[model samples]
Target: MYLTQGLHRSLQRHPDKPALRHVGDGDVRTHTFAELLRDTGQHAAALQARGVKAGDRVALLAPNHDRLVRALLACWWLGAVACPLNVRWSAPELAYAVSDSEASLLVVDEALAGLVRELPLPVIDFEQLAQEAQGLQALPDVRAGGDTLAAILYTGGTTGRSKGVMLSHANFWTASMTRGAELNNAPDSVSLLVAPLFHVAGLGRLVGQTLVGGTCVTMAHFKPAAVLEAIERHGISDVVVVPTMLQSLLDDPGFAPERVRSLNRIAFGAAPMPPDLLERALQAWPHAEFFQAYGLTETAGAVCINLPDNHRDPAALAQGRLNSVGRAGLGAEIQIVDESGRELPAGQVGQIIVRGPMVTRGYWRLPEASAEALRGGWLHTGDAGRMDAQGYLYIVDRLKDMIISGGENIYCAEVESVLRTHPLVSQAAVIGRPDPHWGEVVHAVLVLADGATAEQLPLPVLRDWCHERLAGYKCPRGLSHVPALPLSAAGKVLKTVLRQQLAA
Candidate 1:
């Protein structure tokens, strides 16, 4: 079945129930289940009218908004794959996804229309489409069965290249069901959606909540005040956030115990949480259940979770194993394999591999890349981890050249790609440096392009240029002018040397 079928049921069961609450531009707007259904149906009709066929790819480049969700559902209803791009990406980045997915139609909000001027694809402004949709009715059924592809989530690729992970209706449904079952979710539950809708963590939370017939209270964007306010204002029952987001909320002086006491649970993932920070959050709330989840985009965002009982146990929390991502879910198999491809014994570090119904089919249109990752029937997650005899999984380090900054993965190649574009850069190497707050920050070492000097191309100017081209977190924080970048025997930039130089 299509993923949006659950929303259809919710519309029938509680037509008048609040389905979404969004705050923007000094206004608070809401949509009842019936209204959302009507609008989405109209959107489906509009999409069909514009030649969006079953199995066609439709891409969205926008932030969190009611219209964004509506467009997604409309695409699902029409049997089109919803490909939502990261709004923070540069024009080149956005263009790469649009071209890679071979998206026939593009959807953008009013604010982002200018960014797509150079792209060759046809565009549909969502705001204008929303106006046009007001006069339409329910569209014809175009979807197929449960195995039909529903969405394409583009995740990490080698050397900062992009790879699209194809998720079927079954993949999404099973992930939501497995996570909901683990959490013991109820129909009346309410969830807070503060993460960007583009990420797997956020997408899974939204779909999981909807599957359980729960309400999602969304923020246009995450801010400390907005998060706390929504939790209090909407009586939000659940929240899925990264550790950085949780830390920011805890740092806010305006945060109150009473406001958080009403929440059922707070789920954190995407990056590891420091033990001290987790303890602080517990002391501040003392009421809500805390769960630490760990997974990748390939697993549909979750594989393991550290439950509330583990969080509250001093022994578990201190051994820091409570912070460890829990064992595999039902019907899921997790293995630790060495570099030589042999299965390692318990308590040995190796890459974590997962195989389950929730795993994605493969990367879109990239057969060789897909085969490399899906070899031996397991999704080869580039995360180094080990499992204990008791079966809990412990994440050790990233095997890939990826950095987790503020819960966002900043791949070294992606940063290097941008840095090479600089006029003053002949060569570049990007590395992560430890940050007390962000866990790690991107640092760049550059060898000047022909005639540039450190004084000629100041750090601020170089940073500003990169800020415009790359996502904020991916931009290099520290700039080092180098005489030459270290190279290996094969003539590849040696990142280890750069890291040592920075530390020294």
Candidate 2:
């Protein structure tokens, strides 16, 4: 059940098959399963040479690259935990992660080598490691059991400084299998890797593809035109993207049905998909099946998935099922519970809790936080949601994102949904603003669509539009038009950033 088990199987079954096709700036490199295995073995030996051992931590700071994947596989092969630092993080932030994880070895891309100059760890340039490993003998296999720690993924620091999520080999294996079964990842599947590998969604997809001996086409970073070009050139069958990336692709001048005609499925998550955006995507890629995944870093990746059939069913859409994050994924259990931790009846919004093998063991070195989150034998996902009678889950919003104004509870998603329906609104994020009278009031920051302007859709007009579809109290009292909303690398709007700006 180790994460590297799939690679072992792929090597034995399809050694000469294409395993990776990496697209970088003016460069294209392909690797067969045999070649990937040989490189991974060399990398394992190299890590051993650098003094990394079982139970040790190895940190990586780089963008999506074949070398990064090899590094991860190499760590797992040696029974060491791989800590992938966000490439978008500042030097101080990266230092904090490496320090908190107690990583003994740091691997950085040649381009980012300067960022970790002051870090107190043995550093290995990614390219240099490859060069050094070229003539090294393959290390003997070191088998890690299912319970062995495989990775420590850090969460986005919205509440405070991010905590390290300790995931085991079992967690990664179960999550990949569960998602693969639900997504129907075939051995012939050719998946495009556009999401940052540091995120669970991207890394999990990479593992799933390897598990099935499928081809993975890696992109250095997400670019709408480059993505379209790769899909056309590689005939990529499966892709995972966030809603913001989907919207960007739709807006790109190179986007057309013909360019992605080979795509079989498009899986999306990391944020709620605006219905308008979903509708536009459906129109653009009519032949491709659409899926919406819902989970957290703690769950490895997706624990629930809205299938393509659910997306295309008119009755489901009319009944609001299309808005669902879908039913629980294979081998996962989902429940909505009241504040007292009792399971609630269907349609009642409560804290969404899950119990599954895919859930991470706990946060690294944060026992108090771990106990709080993993209490009562369930992973208490700090998200407010409801399950329909048939098991569809509708994510209301983050529990913290729920706004109380004039003693009425207002879910930001409801307001954002209404705001997005307006013809002029392209993107919208709603947050709670401090108010002495009401405790807090609803505020919206929006980006207007093409050919639209703030002058054309004034605050008064926007309020009226929201009023037509929402309760008077839920209508935003304050509106600000911006060209773009602050976002995390995973494509989620940084509501914390928005709140900070409002407070200042």
Best model number under lDDT = 2
RMSD of candidates 1 onward, in order: 10.6, 1.1
lDDT of 1 by residue, 1-504 (tens): 567776778877998888877875667889888887788889988888888899999999877777888898888888999898877667888899999999989999778888888899889789877887778888855655487988898763324577899988888778787776678877788887777677787778877876666787777677788788888888888888765577668878888888777787888877556555677788887887888887777888787777788888878867767747888876678899998779999998788999998898899998998899999899999888889888899886567657888897676755775687777776677889999999999898998866788998777888898899888888888989998876422123557667778899
Error of 1 at 297 (Å): 0.8
What stretches of model 1 exceed 4 Å from their correct place?
141-145, 156-159, 318-320, 401-504
- lDDT tens digits, residue span 278-302, model 2: 9999988888899999999999989
lDDT of each: 0.80, 0.91
Error of 2 at 250 (Å): 0.5
In candidate 1 the C-alpha lDDT for residue 77 amounts to: 80
